[model samples]
Target: MAGGITEMGEPYSPYVGLVYMFNLIVGTGALTMPKAFATAGWAVSLALICILAFMSYMTTTFVIEAMAAANAQLRWKRREQEAVKDSDSSDYSDDEVIVRGRSEPLEARPILSVQRGGSSPDQFDIVERVEMGQMASLFFNKVGVNMFYICLIVYLYGDLAIYAAAVPMSLMEVACGNHSCSAGSVKYNDTDLCWGSVKRKDAYRVFLTIFTLLLGPFTFFNAQKTKYLQILTSVMRWIAFSMMIILALIRIGKGEGQGRPPAASFSGIPNLFGVCVYSFMCQHSLPSLVTPISDKRRVGRLVLADYALILAFYSLLSFTAIFCFAGGDLRDMYTLTFTDSCHALDAAPLRYFLGLFPVFTISTNFPIIAVTLRNNWKSLFHRDGGTYPWVVDRVAFPLITLVPPVVVAFCTHNLESLVGITGAYAGTGIQYIVPASLVLLSRRHLEPALGRGAVNKHRSPFRHTFWVGFVLAWATFCLMFVTANIVLTETKPKN
Candidate 1:
C-alpha cells in the first residue's frame, strides 16, 4: 500500500536528495552571476542576492507545502472512489445518513478526517509526485492555468535561447582565438576575421548550424538524458566550476587582481535581481526532487541546508570573480574570463578547455530543454480525451520549440540581457507568484475535504498568509523595476 502511494520513481534518502537540489539550483545562472555582480557592485549584489535567496526559499517552502496538499487531495479522492465502489457493491447501504434532519452523502463528510484526526501527520506526507503544472491545474482556474503555461513557455524559450547562443559562442572562441597564448588579453569583435575571409560571427553561425543539425531533432521525439550522461555532465560541471574558482583565487592572492568595483550601481540592480532570481530557481522542479525522498519529515531542513550551501557557493564564486577580473574585462559568461591569455592562466590546453566548456555542457542540455518546451506546448492545447494529428505532434510542436530560440540566438548573442529579461518577468511568475498562489489556493481547496483545523506537516515555516502576500508584492516590484530599467536604458542617448 505504501509502494502504491509513491510509485512515480525510486525513493532515496533525504541526504541524497539534498545533493540533487544543490546541483539543480547551481547551473548556468551561476556562470552569469559574476558579470552581474561586477556591474552592480559587489556590495549591492550581495545585499540583493541575500534578500532574494530568502524570498526564493520562502516560495520554495510554499511549493513543497502545496505538493503535500496536492498529495493529500489525490489520496482522498482515490479513497473516495474506493468508498463509492464499496457502497455500490453493498447497494448504497452506507451512501447517506441523516444529520439533524438534513440528508447528507457519505462522501460529503471530510474524507481526510482519519489521517488528519491523528497526531502522526500522515495526511500531508508527500507520498505522491504532483508536478507544478498538475498542482496548477488542480488549484487554479482555466484562466490561471493558461497564464501559468504561458509564463513557463516563455521562460523555457529564454533558457533555450541562452543555451543556443552559449555553445556556438564557446566554439567560436576556441576555434578562432589565438592558440599560442600570444593575443595578450584582447576581446574579439564580431566582424573580426576567424580565418582568411570568415568573420567570427560567421563562424558562430556555422557552429550554430552544426549544433542545430545534431541536437534539434531530439525535440521531435521523447528524449531524456541517460543516467550515465547525467553523471558525466555532473562530474564535468564540478571540475569546471572548481577550476575557475581556484584560478580566480590564485590571481587575486598574487596581488594581480584587476578589479576595483564601486560600492553601488543603481543601473545594474535590475539585471542583478533577475540573475539572483534565476540562480535560486528550483521551485518549479521541487516536486520531482522532494517527492522521491524516502523520509520527508525533515525535508524542510534539507531544503534550508541546500539553500545555505548554494548561497555560500554563489557568494564565493562571484566574489572571487569580481576581485580577480576588472569590471570592464568581465565577460558575460564567467568561464570566458579564463579563456584569454592572462597572468592567471598560461596553459593553452586549460584555456581551451575553459573556453569550450559551455559547448560541451550546454549542448547536452539543449535537447532536454527543447523536449520539455515541446511537451508544455502539447499540454497547453491538449483536450481532455482528444489526440493530436501525427504531423502536429511530431512536426509542428518540435518546429515551434526549436526555431524561435535559434532565431533569437541568431539575431543577438547578448546572453546577459537575455537572461536578465527572462528571469525578471517570466522567472518572476514561476519563482514567486505561482508558488504563492498555489499554496494559498491549495489550502483553500483542502479545507472542505480536511476541516479548517487540519494541518499540513510539510507546511512552510512562513505559514502565515502575510508571507504569501509579501512574495507576491516583491515579485510585482521586481517586474516593474526591470521593465522601467529597460525602457529608460533603451531610450537614453547612445552617444
Candidate 2:
C-alpha cells in the first residue's frame, strides 16, 4: 500500500498492466490542467507537456533498470551462500552468515550475468516485488532512505489534502450552485449563503465532515480496491473524461468556442510547469505496475505507447476545454465548469452528473490513498520485525493521516496552490530526482560485478551518464525556480 508490492489484488496480465498504468498516470491532475493551459497559453503547455512526458518516460526506464539490478544482486547473494555450503572449502560459516545478514553487497551480480554456471533463467528478472521504498533502503544510506520517506510521506499528505478538499468542494458546488440555467450569472463565492446565514465555506466544511465520517475509518486498516471496484472506477473515469472532451468539441464545432488564449504568457509558466509535473507523475507506482508484466521484454516500449496516448489525451481534453470556454471562465475543478447551466452545457441531469463526478471518483480514491499514506507512515517508523501496538496501529496512524488534511480543507477548498506546491516540490523529488539517483547508483554498484560491457536488457534509452546528470540538473533548476516563484508571490504586495 506504500506504492510497493500490491499483494492485495490478484495478479494480472501485461495487457492489464498497460491499462493499469494508463489509469495511474492519468488522474485528478488532468482535471486541473485545462486551467493551467489556459493560463500559460496552449503552445507553451504543449511543448512542456511533451518534454515532461519524455522526461518522465526516461526516468521510468531508469527505475525499471534499477529494479532489475536489485533482483540480480539478490540472486547473486543466494548463489554465493549456496556455493559456500556445497564446497565445504573452509569453516567460514560465521563469515558467510554475517555477509548474508547484511543487505546484498552493492556489486553483487546474478550468476547468469557473470557468464558462469547459469542455472536460473529468471536471473535478470525485473518483475521482482522490489518496491521503491525497499529499493531506497537497499541502495541509499540511512540519510537517503529517511529523506526518501520524508518526501514520499509529504507527497501522500498533499494527496490526501487534495482529495479532502476536492470531494467537499464538488459537493458544496453541486448542492449550493445555481441550477436554474440562468444566463450571465456571476459564479458563486464562499461568501454566498448556502442556507439562512450559512456561508458556502461552512457548507464545504459540512461536506468535509461527512467525507471524514464516511471514509476516514478505512485508514485504520489495510484497504484495497477490489477488482470489480477498479473496473467500475476506470469506467467512470473514462466516461467523465470523454464526456468533457466530446461536449467541448461539439460546442466548438458549432462555432461557439469563446477562448482566445494568448500564444505565450511568461507569468503563467511557473504554475503550468508544476501542473505538467503533477500530471505526468507515475514513477512512485512504477514497481507495482512494472513488476507484474507477463512479458518483460517490451515493458519499456509499452510504457512509451502509454505515455504517448496520455499526452494526446491530455492535449485533446485541455485544448477542447480552453477553446469551448473563455480562459477566465474555467473552473479549478474542470468538471464544475461543465456542471453549471452555462452556455457550454445546459441539460439539468447531465449537469448534476458532471458536478458530482469528482465527488464520486475522489470518494472512491480517498480511502485507498489514506490507507497508502497510513502504511507509508508505518513503513517509515517500522524497525526490523517490529510491529506497532494495537492502539498505535488502529488509532494513532489513522488520526494522524486523516486529521490534518481535513483541517486544511476546512480552512480553504481552493486547490490551485495546493496542487501546484505539492507537484513542484514533493512530486518533482519522487518523479525526477529519485529515479535518476536510483539508476545512477545502481549502475555504479553493478559496474564491478557485471563488467562495463555487460548489457542490461531493461536499460534506459537515455542510459548515458550525461543524461543522468542532465536529469538531476534539470530537477534542481525546476525546484529552485518553483521556490523562487513561491517566495516572490508570497512577498509581493497586493496590486
State which candidate has the highest lDDT. Answer: 1
Off by more than 4 A, model 2: 1-13, 85-122, 182-186
Q: Report the lDDT tens digits of candidate 2 across residue range 251-324.
A: 89999888898878877788888888888989888877788777777888899999999999999999998888
Candidate 1, residues 1-495: lDDT per residue as tens digits? 001133558889999999999988999878999999999998999999999999999999999999889888887888766755665676335677443456578767555443445433687888777888889888899999999999999999999999999998889888888667665766788999998999999999999888888998888887777878877878888899999999888888888899888889999999998888889988888877888889888888989999899999999999999998889888898887777555557888888888977887788888888888898898899888899999998899999999999999899887888888889988999999999999999999998777778788999999999999999888888888888988999999998
Q: What's the CA RMSD for each of the models?
A: 3.0, 3.9
**Candidate 2, pairs of clashing residues:** none
Candidate 1's C-alpha runs over 4 A off are 1-6, 93-120
TM-score of each: 0.94, 0.92
Model 1: ten consecutive residues of lowest lDDT: 1-10
As a whole number from 0 to 100, the lDDT of residue 131 in candidate 2 is: 86
